[model samples]
Target chain A: MDQQKLFVQIALHSWNTQIARAEKVFNSYSESEFYKQIAPGKNRIIYLYGHLAVYHDLLKETLGLDTGKYSVLSPLFLQNPDNQESEMPPVKELKAIWNEVHCDLKELFNNVAPEDWFKRHNAMTDADFEKDPSRNRLSVVLNRANHVAYHLGQVVLVKPENI
Target chain B: MDQQKLFVQIALHSWNTQIARAEKVFNSYSESEFYKQIAPGKNRIIYLYGHLAVYHDLLKETLGLDTGKYSVLSPLFLQNPDNQESEMPPVKELKAIWNEVHCDLKELFNNVAPEDWFKRHNAMTDADFEKDPSRNRLSVVLNRANHVAYHLGQVVLVKPENI
Candidate 1:
């Protein structure tokens, strides 16, 4: 594999590893514990779960990948940290949403052509490039991985014993 | 402020927002739930905390910034998900470490001369530069914000229902 291919491979593997790791940590919490917040300003476990699920869907849309029935930017799925009861799905339902989103992402990855990986897609603004001047797909992938790993740390920090 | 300063300001604000968000979610879990692995093969709360603390320290060192007594790439701080018991730190200690590291990062950001933010550091490896020419201080900082936001999602997901 060439450099771009190698980077994509690393991204795929890293995402898989993070997902696996997150799944293990997530499963250990009870339903109630998953929704608990230790302090007034803190977020509940449900918020984190919802955030991940929503983000994956958004990323797929940003990359122009198919996200099935999910609208990546749906307001219904977005959480306001202050509004605990607003637009929150039940734990089981949210997990299902997460799984579905992940599945779509996997399919998108599998179908992405190696050449296509270098195609520049403007993520922040959602613009499509006529010819991607910034051939930096690998950087984007790495960015995403770094993004996931960073948040994973927060999830680990707040567990009861650690507090 | 010039465009460069504007960019840095935005980046800094984004990072601060994300760190605060993560802290909020983390404060919500019970001791057992915080350490518990909810999904198979996922990281426990402590493991995630340790990784972020260590990685942030590494980024600081990579940029030739002062990290006080913290050493980058410390093997002792590296947590292997497979060995949860060996890697977990007490919640208080982990939070302290995170706070200290974040403070160091904040200081680094505060002290950044505009020119330095745009300066191109030597690539960590040949592959990093080969992947993209924009892998400079600005890009690195931007990428770091994305990194933090991604992991913050995970923290929110795994939080316990009762503190």
Candidate 2:
């Protein structure tokens, strides 16, 4: 296995591990617990899920894949910092969006050609690529994986029903 | 640049960003805030720091770097789940250990040769290397960065002053 192939495997594995960890936390939530904050004035389950759903919207374009199924979420959940008060869709609606968005992403992942993984992202210019040749699909995947793991740790800390 | 050099730069940059982001959260703490939880039944600030400190102790060996310190923290903070009450050092003692550990690590990072970045980590063999070429000093650094980012999100949510 060459380094590029191995790097893609590691990055994808990391992304899968990170997403599974976060899903476990979200799966454990009960109805009431979904809206409860990790700490006072901190983000709740609904907000975090919606935020991630919105942010993953960028991953499509960033990875040279396709997107655009969740723009309605952009206004309500995207711009505000976590825990900021805002009008929100019902939990069921956000869950639907989250599922739809991730399904599209996974489908895109399956269709990407092997050589596409090494291609520069859409925004990379010739000069920028020269300076940081690591700016490719592998870097994008690794970065998003790290981003997911960071937020996963917090999502797990929501106030427990018994606490 | 060749893929090897690009990989090293990406790994080091990721590690540095993760460390800095975590440090920014810790540096914002006051004396009392360091002991507070993200929320009820979640990790306290000091405990998370102690936990990361203990875990990073393994990085020296994992990356083929040297280590001579920080075993004292292993029992108190390592292996234990967060929020479990236990004996603890004073904040100053843990902070001292954290500083010493990182100083040693930074020195180790500086001393690692360019070729060393692609070298297999301790215990990795010919067969394993062929199967997972990404398993090297660079992967260790990148994995540790993701780990730190996970904990940093929790460390940042320590109960706010006003809310």
Candidate 3:
């Protein structure tokens, strides 16, 4: 296999693995469980879910793909910390948005040629990219994959004690 | 830059990014803070630190590199859940081990060529690896990088809430 292609595949594999782990945790939690904080005074699992959803939704634009359809989520999930004066969407609506963002991201990511991932996304100016070309689209995926795994660790704290 | 080499560098960049984040979280906490649990009835921050230390130690062997010197920590940190009958190493010693493991790993990893990371490590049997060539050294790094980030999230809950 071409080494570069192989590298991309492996990166994607890790991304998928984290995403699947997050999905498993999300599916396992009851709605009430999502409301519970991972720790005292920390954000709840639902907040983390919404955080990831919005980040991923914005990721499409970061990839220089389509603009995110869920721009409204940014204020609730991204700009502010959880438990702001504003209210978050219902858990049912957040779940749908999560599913839709990932579905769209999967298709959008698939359309990108393996080589094109090396190019800078809209997030970077050409001058800045030239200064540090390491900030490519694939790096975003790598970083965000770890980001997902990071939050998943916190989210798993809501697991029922028995099992 | 060659795309293949660039990919390796970015992968390493992500690995280093997570490591720095983990290190920051580990360094920020006081020794007493390390004793605090991420949540009620879960593992303490110190245990997770030792957990990562032990895993990174074992990773040397998984990479077909040097045997881990910290094998003694395996039973305390890896095999059993927190609060077993056996006692863990002191916080001071665990911190020393964590530093040592990462120091050794950094040197060992630098020695391996970019292309060499694509080769299968000893942890996988030849036939099994042949069936799935993606199980390479680089993949291990990617997986473990996320593993570190995952635990880092849980560990951060031990933070002194003001920040």
Task: Provide i-RMS per model in Å.
Answer: 10.2, 3.6, 2.4
Better of 2 and 3 by DockQ: 3
The candidate, 1 or 2, that scores higher on lDDT is 2
Q: Which is the winner by TM-score between candidate 1 and candidate 3?
A: 3
Over the stretch B1-163, how does candidate 3's per-residue lDDT look in tens digits?
8776787788888888988888888998888887887888888888899999999999999999899998887888888778834576888998899899999999998998878888898888989888888888888899999999888888888765711
Q: What is the DockQ of candidate 1?
A: 0.14
Reference-based lDDT, residue A112, model 2? 73
Question: What's the lDDT for candidate 3?
Answer: 0.86
Clashes of each: 40, 0, 0
User: A17-130 in candidate 2: lDDT tens per residue?
Assistant: 777777777778886777877667777778888888887876787666875667766776666655456776787877787777777877787777655676788768878977
Rank list by TM-score: 3, 2, 1
TM-score, one value per model? 0.51, 0.85, 0.95
TM-score of chain B of each: 0.79, 0.87, 0.93
- Candidate 2 residue lDDT tens string, B40-156: 767778888888887787679777687646766677677666655686788888788777777788878878876688778885887898677767777777778889988887777
lDDT of 1 by residue, B1-163 (tens): 2434544553455457667766776776766666765334555666666666777777775666663455532454553342565645578877788898888888787998865765555446657655653455655555555566655555555544321
Which is the leading candidate under lDDT?
Answer: 3
User: lDDT tens string, model 3, A38-148?
Assistant: 888888888899999999999999888898888877877888778834677888999999999999988987888878888997888999999888889888999999999
Q: How much is A3 displaced in model 2, in angstroms?
A: 1.9
